[model samples]
Target: MLYGNRSTMSALSRMTEGNRLAQCFLFYGDKGLGKKTLAKWFAQRLLCSGTGEKPCGVCKNCRTVQKNVHPDVIWVPHSGKLQGFSVETVRDICSQAIVAPNSGDKKLYIFADCDRMDTRAQNILLKIIEEPPAFTYFIFTAGSRQTLLPTVISRLVPFAVSACTEDETLTALRELGWPDADAQEAVAAFHGNIGCCISFLEDDNVKLLVSLTKEVVRCIIDKREYDLLKVFFSVSNDRNSALWLLHDLEMVFRDAVTFRLGQDIPSISCDPVGAGMLAGKLSTAKGQYFHKCIGKAHDAIAANVNLQLVMSALCAELMSGK
Candidate 1:
């Protein structure tokens, strides 16, 4: 059961109830936004056999789907160093789509994290996606709809998933048996990103990133160029960690810009005091310039640029202030 984004859930229910659900569906959102979970729930609703609710959870079909043992439901996982599906994998899925359903009335293929899918792979899926068989359905979850090509986007129904309110997130975490202090700490660090909040509590890597993000923000605020570079160097070998750190730092810069404008913004900054200090130290233009540099660094990282070099250059860019 999802706690937030009732609008998207309602839209899914309407599509299912109205018998207007499209052959291809896209659920797009940032990491930890539960696109894949929503995809699973939608799958349950579509394949449920019980008499009451669409996904009468007690039914054998619903139970099998919940346990991921449903014969007619296929979960496509990524398979590469970059965690992307290859052209061959896409072709295999296309071939499998022509087969008859194994058990249920419909055959559903779910592709999670479609953001990492290469364009060639997406092209391979075009034919099946545009005109799938009567008994076939395709579902994809991505960090952003822009990750897919326009042709692919044109053939699919897209749903944008969003995080819950902070209050709601806090409540949900507590209901998960987290203590009040733990819940409040997670909420402060990650706001409504329930997955990330859970990660923050359980994953030491996440805790390190949070600390590093705060450290990076403080270094920027104090104009400590070398220290900034040094902090980034610690996580230089881990690409995902680097990206996560950059995103959190970007959030801090965003809050700083918001603070400069005298606007009250709900911030997910790990270092709110540093954000306020940055708001005083840098002009809006300068703040924005750093923010854009972060974007450049993000792209560089995504393109597989040398992480240490990228960090060094980003440190220089942030300190240059021109």
Candidate 2:
């Protein structure tokens, strides 16, 4: 069950019910928007053996597809290199696609992260995509259509997957047995990206990162520059975790900014007293500056800049403003 993209889902359902579903569909949107999930659901619906609403999940075909055991359903292999999806892999899948379905009336081919496929590979796939066999259906997922070739984009039906609403996200978290407070915090942390929120909930490191983020903010407000240095140093070795910490800080400061504006926004930090104190310490201008610094740090990390240097520079900037 996808939370958002009701329009996309409804359109797909109508296509399925009307027997007019496109042979190739391009599911493009921001990452973590559940495009792949929707593609899988659509695949199951197309291959379903039951007479009920599309994919009757209990049906043998639906069950096999759900478990990734359906012989007629094929996934294009990723090359596991920087370019991803080699020309050879694309050509091979294109050739295999010509074969008839072994199980169901239709054959489904799924291409995940198609945006990462090399231009050469995409070009190689262009002919097959444009004129796939009658029994074959293609589904491709990408962060955006701009990453694909114009020719490739023109040949497929586009399905835009949108972000989930805060309410929809909260409902999903609650249904997963998360307490109200925890679910609220998760929503704030991930901004209603259900996939990200679920990942955050499942990771114990996220809890520690949230606590560390709150403490770092308190240190900055209290002008404890030395303590802030120590805290930043503790996570310097792990760039990935450092990146997550930066994200957590950004969320906290964002909430503080919203709080200062007198908006009753949900906050990632559970400690209202701490958040209020931080909000009082930083005016809108300073909050905005801090946010800018966090964004720069993010770019620096992505550029492979020294983690310790970046963290030290960020801490210094936060303290200097005090």
Q: Per-residue lDDT of 1-322 in model 2, one digit per residue for the tens? A: 6677878887887776655557889998855678888888888888899887777899999898888888988877776534368877888889989999998788999998786677888899889888888888899998788878999999999988877888999998898899999888777767667876777788988777777887898898889999999889988998778877887677677777888999976654434556678789888989888988987896588457899999999999998873
Off by over 4 Å in 2: 17-21, 81-83, 209-322
- Lowest-lDDT window of 10 residues in candidate 2? 266-275
The estimated TM-scores of all candidates read 0.95, 0.72
Clashes of 1: 0
Best by TM-score: 1
> What residue pairs are clashing in model 1?
none
lDDT of each: 0.86, 0.81
